[model samples]
Target: MAAQGVFITFEGIDGSGKSTQARRLADHLRAIGRDVVLTREPGGSPGAEEIRRLVLEGDPDRWSAETEILLFTAARRDHLEKTIAPALAAGKAVICDRFADSTRLYQGITRGDLRGVVDQLHALMIGREPDLTFIIDMDPALGLARAKGRNGAEERFEDFGEALQQKMRAGFLDLAREFADRCVVVDGNRGIDAVAADVARLADGRLG
Candidate 1:
């Protein structure tokens, strides 16, 4: 059967420009006369947006790994029901800045077991998988530096030490390996236009 709509997710460590590229891809698709919805994880729907603020801004010291995972799942459930599923059902391509893979990487690093976290999220998702995922791979040190240069209020996760950031980077790579067929790891060290071009090509290929 033909797909109802194409779902593409972008993922990466902080400063990897996943959000920027995701937006670029959405614009490119719209330019080509495709219906598209551009959104993000943990905050696409109203209910999910509340959860997102709590998860991102709440006290990190008080959050346990288990609690973090469950909160992420809760937000994802709402996002799926209120944003993703509807768009796909209507035949609009959905380009998400981050999604399930973010949970896998962030929670896996915090929990110390990539496979277990992936399994739990997969079960929670009930088979809703992205048609394609682009992992904007970036060096941890460089990424963190870039993130710091952005000069924004630090979220709880952003306050994590260098070691934790490195672990998260590793977690993302591990996830890409485990889901090799669906994941494309794009090097993110290039200029924005160059990176956007690569993402545009990928989206164009799928939407063609």
Candidate 2:
């Protein structure tokens, strides 16, 4: 029988360095002789990647909270069907930069009070959750500044500005509390190496 694979996700307000940490952890796991498949939500599969551009590249007000919830769910369903599930079935550790938890916040809370809608759609279309999640915590202003510095096309969320990030930070913390068993919060205020080290250690405990 194939060894069981693990589903891991990194989440935070934009520019919390969760993506960097996710990459580091994937490298660490690979270096330790484990099979790892590093991916990201909203764009893991080709179909989802198309959706990613639609949702992430447009104006901040381009889509309402309800519409975005639908778009994200569609993307996530495609991602799971095309990428995440196949890798996990093959017994490869799947490391994702972001996942459903992002929708739970960005649309569920920050954009509007539609957690119920997001939850209902998630339960219907995407029924999976990460086995382990790292919530990189950081100051909203700092994170927004870092995100803006990237000057990337996927700046719709960043354009929402620091206030949205602040709400997102708090919402993520609340989510951590709600799902304490799988969610681990890491301070993102220090050096990348320091944060990566902590993530690797925690992941080791679970991946063992």
Candidate 3:
């Protein structure tokens, strides 16, 4: 039988470059003959993608914070079942752009007292965690500026602005500390290539 696959996830503020790094690392792994499945949260699978549109698009206040959290959890469950599980069972390394960390931070900041609820829902519906998670650390101002430069239909979360971005960054850093066993903090305030290279190096270490 093939060996168990490696699961890696990227987490950070909206524009911390985690997505790009995730792609770069996937490419690096594939170039070295490693089977890789690159995907993203909230939309990796078909059902989850539809949920993503509902939760990310439309009025910022379309759904209450609590409802939004439920939507995210359902979408995550779908992503896990339909995309992540099958890929891993096939012994293919999976690199996801974002995961439950985003939900924790977003819900924690939005709902204020929902952190415990977030944890409970995650454990109940999606108990699995990535083998390695890279939290791209960077200044919120820089990240927000980067996000603004690439405004898209998903501006719902970015509308929180710099203040919320700062809070989210702190949340991700705190998660890195709390889950140090599988979380790595990569400095992401530099240029894209530099950050991608650093992430790739760290991921390579994990693979070996």
Candidate 4:
């Protein structure tokens, strides 16, 4: 059956304020009486949460690009079957902080071709596209600076240097173009309120 509820995803490079804006958008929807559920990929369901640790906490040398992609797919499958699908089935709008696009950007950077990875994810889990995806675009250098300023600690991926981050940023823009129909590229260089306003507008259109 076609889903009755809306599924929206937030995407961006690190420190693009996607999480914060996603929460704001969810809150706005709830205020208007829409059934909303806020969630995140790589760490939404119980099984996915466990996979999140394995993906993020391990030593950089411990995992190859393919291994990282596989782990992400596993987490996504768990999240879809256990959390996302169920919530949407119940007629609740699901706003996810990060989704399949992350893998396309990160894994794509690690392993040149991302089409195969995306195909694998689609095969493993039912191909479910977000009703709307807000891609908060920002300069890699500025975004990383914000990330570093907010948190002293760094994960395996976050520890990557500027060049790598630039590549990931490019990947995000590329994916946004590839999925233009489903994606909205939000300018994230402005203040949080400005960014949140764009997110609110997008959610309002979808939820209405």
Candidate 5:
């Protein structure tokens, strides 16, 4: 709300097409001559990127929920200071691939009790939230199938398997409902073009 430009973030379980939609939305806005800065977490900023590698490219049990939350918050803080804040201050829309909502959901899944800690840390360290958060909603099974087809070294979280994915999907939907003010649930089961159109239109509406 303090930003001169809009802040938008894409959130969803893996393979829900959130990343693709984020890219398309950024492109759409830029084509219309909007100054847009497209970025992603946990490595949007240089320091954060280093933290991203440490957190992402390791065993599933690499870090405890508490530690993971700290790393994510640190990355987010750096991202905000180095990239997001500067872009918005310069009056450019900041479109992030994944943001705090992902942190809430993922950490929630890893350890239910830590949700409180995550929220507290977020408030203390990273106080800002996106102006609009697009939750690309989709079925867990299908998302898993789509995710499994992709190969990446950052497969630790993906290895949580279908059960955690389902829980994460539900958690995202619940967040959308809980934070209906800024969160919009976009149907991710549809074609990419259709989904992108909806996301772009919604974002454009906010740009007003």
Candidate 6:
């Protein structure tokens, strides 16, 4: 059967404010009477949330790129089975902070050329993509600063430092082009309200 709900995801380098934008979009949709579920990965469902700490709270080199791919794919599969699929089946809009696109870059190119492995695992396990994605583009250096300033436990990825963040920013832009039909590159260097406004406008158009 055709899916009855909308699946929207936000992607960007750490601290690009995609998370905030995702929340705003979900709240906006819900206020308008749409059933919305806001979630994130490598942790969405119960099992996935457990995996999130393992992947996100350790040292930067704690997990090899290959190992991270397997872990992330496992978490994604659980999230789909327990959260995303059910929400869509129930005709609710699902706004995800990050999805497979993140794995495709983080585990795909960061340590080495492992994107093919990530893709294969995804196809074998998760086998889905967001219907709409907002790739929040930002300056890598500034984004890294902002991310670290939060002093969050999930600073493992941020600890990879500016170089990795630069690579990630470029990788996200490339993915936006590669998936242009469903991806929108939003300038996240702007103020929060401005960025959120653009996001809401684009999302409303799509949801309409």
lDDT of each: 0.81, 0.93, 0.88, 0.81, 0.89, 0.93
Candidate 6, residues 30-113, lDDT tens digits: the string is 889988899998898999999999999978889899999999999999999999999999999999999999999999987799
Clashing pairs in 5: none
Clashing pairs in 1: none
Alpha-carbon TM-score of each model against the true structure: 0.92, 0.98, 0.96, 0.92, 0.96, 0.98
Q: Residue-pair clashes per candidate, as listed?
A: 0, 0, 0, 0, 0, 0
List model 1 lDDT by residue over 1-208, tens digit each.
1269888999998888888999998889899888899999778999989888877774656577767788888888889999999999988899898887787767755555654866577685645889899999888888888887877654677667567678777878888898988888888999999999988887667556
Higher-lDDT candidate of 2 and 5: 2
Tens digits of per-residue lDDT for model 3 on 120-172?
A: 99999999999999999989998888887896898787887788898888888
CA-RMSD of model 2? 1.2
Native-vs-model 3 lDDT?
0.88
Better of 3 and 6 by lDDT: 6
Q: Residue by residue across 1-208, what tens digits does model 2's lDDT show?
A: 1376889999999999999999999999999998999999789999999999999997889999999999999999999999999998989999999999999999999888999999999999989889999999999999999999999999999998889999999999999999998999999999999999999999888767
Error of 5 at 193 (Å): 0.5
Task: Tell me how candidate 5 scores on lDDT.
Answer: 0.89
lDDT (Cα, tens digit) per residue for candidate 5, span 8-122: 9999988999889989998998899888899999989999999999988878889888889999999999999999999999888999999999889898554566788888988
Candidate 1 residue spans exceeding 4 A from truth: 1-3, 114-118
Worst 10 residues of 2 by lDDT: 1-10
Candidate 2 regions exceeding 4 Å error are none
Which residue runs of candidate 4 sit more than 4 Å off their true CA positions? 1-3, 152-154
- TM-score of candidate 4 on Cα atoms, chains taken together: 0.92
Q: What is the lDDT of residue 5 in candidate 5?
A: 82
Off by over 4 Å in 5: 1-3
